[model samples]
Target: MIIWFTTLQIVVAVAAGAFCAIAGLAGRRPSDFSVGALALVEVLLIGQIVMAIVAPFAGNPPSGDPLEFWVYLVSAALLPIGGVIWALLERSRWSTVILGVIALAVAIMLWRMQVIWTVQVG
Candidate 1:
């Protein structure tokens, strides 16, 4: 994974996660703003997917097991979707917090994926 892009994803994910968490703690219910923030995170993940597809072809293949990288990528990509679904179904303050937690988890997973892509040795 590209350092700059990974950094960007982590930053955005953390920011979004914090925003949602604070909102939930303030007794706020799931709103468009929270969902939109997650959508943005999802968009970044989609970009990461594209980059992952191209990087190998561009001679930046993973130093670790490609399957491990892919599993992380796919799982990270699903977090936002699941979070949104949970919010929609639950429609409570806790759901908002869960969404925030999911975003944070995504951020952590992205970091792990970066390590798998560039640091870990197979």
Candidate 2:
């Protein structure tokens, strides 16, 4: 995985998490801004996925286990998609809660990705 993209994902996830938390605490539903933020994240994730795929074939394969890398890649790509669907369906504080949960999950995945890459590199 590209460090830059991974870092970007983490930053996006953190920002999303903060927004979700604020919304939940304020007893407000998720706003269109939240959805827009998530949509932006999804777009970035798509780019990251494409980069990952191309890098491997272009002789820059990740040092991590292939299975683990692919799993992280797929799940990372899915989080925003899932968040969008959940937000649209719920449209309440629950939507923000869902986003919060997904953001936490994304953070964990990013940490795991780092660990996996580190193990391989070392």
Candidate 3:
């Protein structure tokens, strides 16, 4: 569990969420940049997935419920892809808002996964 890496992911996730939210609030459908930001977030999520897989081998397995941790990881990874598909179909500012919500969910999920990775409390 790398602190700075998690922080970077959180920042990107939050920024994507904020960008989509603001665009939606301004009555704009998802722009190219919006999609790009989400894509970036997806890339980070992929990185997280890799980290999760390799960490166990590195002797840094999750300290909490492994099932919960894996669930968060998988969900966070899927959120952006789902949002992208939804946005493509909806084609409205509302779609952007939905994407915004998804991004926020990813952020929260990532934070939870981090806790599950780093914390040892029962």
Candidate 4:
């Protein structure tokens, strides 16, 4: 994984998570802002997916188990989708809070993926 790109993803994810959490704490229901924040995270994950595919060919393949990295990548991609859908269906303040939790989880997962990609040795 590219250090810069991973850092960017982590920053965005944290910001988005905080935004959602604050909104939820303020008793706000699921709104465009909350949903959009998660959507942005999802977009970043999509970019990561593309990067993962290309990085290997660019001679930056994972130093750890490729399967582990792909598992994390795929699971991270699914999180925002589930969160957004839950928010849409529930349309509650807690749903917004759930979005926050999902975003934070994504950030942690991304960090782990970075380790799997570049830090861990086979």
lDDT of 2 by residue, 1-122 (tens): 67777788888877877787677677778787777777777787788778877987877776778788778878987987888787888888878777777776776787687667656763
In model 1, which regions exceed 4 Å deviation?
A: none
lDDT of 4 at 119: 85
Cα lDDT of model 4 by residue, 19-49, tens digit: 9998998899989999999999999999999
Off by over 4 Å in 3: none
| Lowest summed lDDT window (length 10), candidate 1 | 113-122
Tell me which of candidates 2 and 3 scores higher on lDDT: 3
Q: Residue 3 error for model 4, in Å?
A: 0.8
lDDT (10s digit) by residue, model 3, range 23-83: 9889999889888889999999898888888889999877899888888888788889989
Cα lDDT computed for each candidate against the true fold: 0.95, 0.77, 0.87, 0.95
Model 1 lDDT per residue over 1-122, tens place: 89999999999999999999999999999999999999999999999999999999999999999998999999999989999998999999999998899999999999999898889877
Better of 1 and 2 by lDDT: 1
C-alpha RMSD values across all candidates: 0.6, 2.0, 1.0, 0.5
Q: What is the lDDT of residue 122 in candidate 4?
A: 69
Off by over 4 Å in 2: none
Ranking by lDDT: 1, 4, 3, 2
Whole-model lDDT, candidate 3?
0.87
Error of 3 at 15 (Å): 0.6
Per-prediction TM-score: 0.98, 0.85, 0.95, 0.98
Candidate 2 local distance difference test against the native: 0.77
Backbone clash count, each prediction separately: 0, 0, 0, 0
